[model samples]
Target: MPRIDWRSDSGSAVAEFSMVAGLLTLLTLAVVQLGLGLLVRNTVLDAAAEGARHAALADSSLPAGEQLTKQLIATAIGEQYAADVSASYGTWHGQPCTQITVTTTLPLIGLIGVQHGLEVTGHAAREVLD
Candidate 1:
């Protein structure tokens, strides 16, 4: 090989590595954020369903269901996520049912996101004494 000029590209590798590393870091963070959002959503949904089932019992009341839902959410994530929980008596498929609704924030960046961005509801058939 004729006169090789190695000095011309001495710092080029560092510059290229920096650019690629930055992009990879951002992509990693985005994936982690998405996973967190999904986890929170699933947790909230499960809590609401459990609450509705509990409230559907003959001896349980709507307020009790709401409290259970709030407690479950607070235990899973944070107290703020447990806010805005409501339970109501309604009809589902023409049968009496207990419904629990949870409205909370959608986590985007480390458990901080748009308020009221996510809403989930759970329903269970009500138990009646013959």
Candidate 2:
């Protein structure tokens, strides 16, 4: 009769799987978190660009642009996401232009997770008189 080394290899696969499964779970969560952060950033950036374009019109005011930026962000994302929005005018290539900057928190585990973690800006040139 041959005796088996039950304690040596039995359930080794299960043990290894448990350890690897935890790491995989964490890696998956990290990717999801990164993706969410990027999505939020792109959304804010697009909103800022849209706001800048709206304000760059010959008939638009800086304040109007700022308001539009906030509204666009809030509508697309959330009101909290547009809490810190600003509009400014500056020169680009020696040409006058409107720049909209949106500074917002980055979501770590969820929205409102990180404080002052990320920032993005958008710009557009006003219609120049010919």
Candidate 3:
């Protein structure tokens, strides 16, 4: 019978690294997902503002205004993300104003059967002379 000593095995370091790598990978993915969601929120707000400004023009008819708003939202947020989005026209301080409400669901990484759905609203007033 021969005695073997395993105290000097170098494979344990590799095994430890492998376990840490999985956790690190998950953390990285979660961060990326959250950052993307914030980016989308900002983009949606900007698009809403642009649409509202365009609609505020006196030359833009009601239907045209609505269409332009929708087009702007669609262009910025993909059709999937813009689903169920709604916009409304109103008057503020005797000037036309547009309000856009955007809604979308963000994917949750490493989370099972869980999702974060958020609604972000943006309002823009027309630069009309009182």
Quote each prediction's TM-score.
0.89, 0.88, 0.71
**Candidate 1 clashing pairs, residues 3+ apart or interchain:** none
Winner by lDDT between candidate 3 and candidate 1: 1
Q: Where's the lowest-lDDT run of ten residues in candidate 1? A: 1-10
20-102 per-residue lDDT for model 3 (tens digits): 99999988988988877677767766766666666666666444544665676577656665564566777667766776666
> Best-fitting candidate, measured by TM-score?
1
Model 1 agreement with the true structure over 1-130: per-residue lDDT tens digits: 6997876977799999999999999999999999999999999999999999999999989999999999999999999999999999999999999999999999989998999999999999999999
Ranking by lDDT: 1, 2, 3
Which has the better lDDT: candidate 1, or candidate 2?
Answer: 1
Please give the range of 10 consecutive residues that has the lowest summed lDDT in model 3.
107-116
The residue ranges of model 1 lying beyond 4 angstroms of the native Cα positions read: 1-8
- Specify the poorest-scoring 10-residue window by lDDT in model 2: 110-119
Task: Give each model's clash number.
Answer: 0, 0, 0
lDDT for model 3, on a 0 to 1 scale?
0.64
* Cα misplacement distance, residue 35 of candidate 3 (Å): 1.8
Cα lDDT tens digits for candidate 2, 28-66: 999988898889999999999989898899888888988
Q: At residue 1, give the lDDT of candidate 1.
A: 69
lDDT of each: 0.96, 0.88, 0.64
